[model samples]
Target chain A: MAELSEDRIAAYAASRLPGARDVAVSGLARISGGASRETYRLRLRYVDADGRSVERPLILRRDPPASLIETERHIEFAAYRAFHGSPVPVPQMLWLEEDPAHLDYPFFVAEELTGFESSPGALTGEAYDPVREKLGRRKWTILGEISRADPEALGLTTVMAKVAPEDCWRRELDYWEGVLDEDEVTPQPIIRAAIRWLRANPPPPAQKISVVHGDFRTGNFLYDAAGEIHGILDWEMAHLGDPLEDLGWGLNRIWCWGQNDLRGGLLPRDQAIAVWEQASGLKADPAALHWWELFNCVKGQGIWVSGAKAWSDGETRDPILIISAWRMFNPQDRAALELMGRL
Target chain B: MKPDPDAVLGYLAGLMVQTIAPQVQPQYLAGVIGMSGMLLGMAAQEWDRAADRLVKENRAIRGLFRQAERVGLDADLAQEVRALAGGQDDDLRISALESVNTGLRAALISLHAAVETRTDAASRALNDAIWAELSASTSRRAYTGSPF
Candidate 1:
């Protein structure tokens, strides 16, 4: 199959905007590092239904041939649409295309949250030096808003599977462990140990179930120098589970960006938790949070191992997979060890 | 071999990321080129150390099995550990060494778990030793660019 052409995208946009004329898609450049989707930024220009000239910048996320995580695009679209204009800032979802005949893959187009940096490496630099604390506060606080959100209220319950608070931990653990089982090309002794430990000791039921931003980490969000979080991206992993799961994932040591002391390379672990606690108006419950944090190590490893398996098996040759495997495998183990109090 | 393999990889990686990636059209492919370069960089680092790291780690894990035998693990686990403790990575090929390493590490997990169960002082000491070895194992496999 041929790669998707920009003209085809413009034609699809024209079809969607029935009354719009001269629908053109330009600047369709693919952004790197989205292992789960083919993300592209494009400039869309057209004359609207009112014969009004309009120019807009948009992001197009289309499904790839095979990806690390399999998720429902509709769910992601719904999650973004649900969060639009809410406390959790997300790009306005414009159109969701499930029929592949137009673009050759299921994709969604949304208004791009432009002019912001999303690189984790940039966060470690001197540029974000001034507002690191403020950014950290905003990061977890927004997570708090997401955790405090009601799926039913947000019309997300229909798309995201409903999970009871008590079973949240088990459900997530089983899913990731199963992935490790099928996808692990190498024996992950540390992950296997972590899994047994997780099963042996499970976190308490969630305080209250909230919308879990399945991949809520510093790199997933749009941050500016003034310490503002414009958008919380990557809802492909969005689900309803223990809110602590998201909190733990953010606090996962693998995200420390080589600075083990600074969780997510933004704030100290305790400080990040405190900011989250204050914003969520909930307790971190040291023991339960610790369990979730360790569990996230296993989850993190599962993702990396799967990426390795995918690349090795020739399913996809995305260098990101090799990077994830080579770059993350050890850090994940170290993180697990630290969480287990063995480090 | 006159030009060091690592140096060659480093040069290629630099060109790919600095020159090729920037000049590539359609940002996604550019990004792939950039990351491929980075992957090459990491591959270079791992290539030189792969054999030494695997040999040292396999030896360390085998030594741990010897300690597990002294601590007196479960009958079945002890038997397995004892057999592995006397084993050798005679085949020094990376693939062969990795195969042995995988089995040894698997047995180590079993030994570690069994040691955790016993309340004996030796078991406690052995358990701690296993953790130390495990920590060392991760450090051996460490990629400089790892986030954690």
Candidate 2:
């Protein structure tokens, strides 16, 4: 795999756009921190149908040889498309090319959301500190919109597989546990113990099946200094499941980047839940919410172990894989134990 | 040892953030170097206590496993526990201790699951001890920068 040159990418783009002329690409540089996909930012120049020259900043996300999470790109592309102009903001998906010949791998292109901070650390800085409350409100408010939106009505059901309202917990638990069963390099007594307890004591059926943004926590969105979220990114794990699953994931202790019990480093867990409940019109039964909270720990462990496996297999030499495996594996187990009352 | 592991890593972290990271091309590699520096800092924090913690935990687990034998655990589990309980650390190397620790923990998980469902008071007590040790194990590995 030689470096992905702008000329090559432009050539690929030109073939796709039949009426386009003077297709050129520049500023093609890889962006860091996306372990699951190869992300790049570039400026696309081309002539449109009216012969007007245009240069637009775009983002390219291509599948790596292996990923931290094995997800279908088509689903993610469809997910972004579904919520593009809705209350739950997302980037405009321009094209999805599955053919390997395009850039040596399947990739998707979207309008690059620019000039906005995406790191959670940015939220703790001076500029954002004043608007912390505003950010938190908008954060949960957007998530509430996602929970409140009807997947079938948004045409998401056509792309995402349907799940029974009652079977959401079982499907997620089984999938994550199966991953641990296959990829765990060592024994995970805490998570294994949590799994047994979950099976023995299951949560009630979901209030309703909603679009569960499987990874809707802080640090996965683009926000400006004024507390406006420009885009909700990373929908690779998005699926149709229990709404509380997304809510519980947002409350996972790992996202408490501020080293406190404040959920998502913004509001108290209960307050965040209340805001979400108020907006989504869903009841977050304490016991059921607890079940999903622990389940997210298992899911976290599964992701970390999968990243370790990817690194050990020599598929991707990205250090985030190793860092996640080393730093998160134990913390995730500890989270599970804390939730289980065993810590 | 004169300069100290933390001091060395602290200096390297400065170099990464201030000098090396700024000069790297292909932004991903630069970010990797920055993260690698952070990993070095974590490794420095672990370096001094790595061997001691392993030794302490190994001894602690063997003690728990020996107690498991007295609770009338199944023959296979008892034999495994007895063998591990009588084991001694022949090598002081961190890697050697870590290898032994991994084997011990694998056995510990089995012993815990075996005794968790038993009806006897002794089995219940042994299970509680296992859970307590597991909790302590996590605390020992916890770092100042841990998100949890």
lDDT of 1 by residue, A1-343 (tens): 6677779988899999988998998887888747899888899999999999999999999998788888899988999999999999998999999998888899999999889999888889998889998999999899988888888999988888988889999999999999998988788777888888889898889999888889999789998999999999999998889889999999988888877788888999889989888888889999999899999998998999888998888988888888888888888899899888887
The local lDDT score (0 to 100) that residue A172 gets in candidate 2 is 96
Give the lowest summed-lDDT range of ten residues in model 1 chain B: B65-74
Please give the C-alpha DockQ score of model 2: 0.65
Clashing pairs in 2: none
**Model 2 C-alpha lDDT per residue in residues A1-343, reported as the tens digit of each score:** 7668999899988987889999999999989746789999999999987899999999999999898999999999988999988999899999999999778999999999889888887676677668877788888988899999999988999999888888999999999999988888777777877887788889999899899888998999998888888999999999999998999889988888854667888788888888898889888999999999999998999999999998898988888898888888777878877887887
Off by over 4 Å in 2: B22-26
Chain A fold similarity by TM-score, each prediction: 0.98, 0.97
Fold similarity of candidate 1's chain A to the true chain A, as a TM-score: 0.98
Model 1 ranges with Cα > 4 A deviation:
B18-20, B71-79
**Candidate closest to the true structure, highest DockQ:** 1
Q: Native contacts recovered by candidate 2, as a share?
A: 0.53
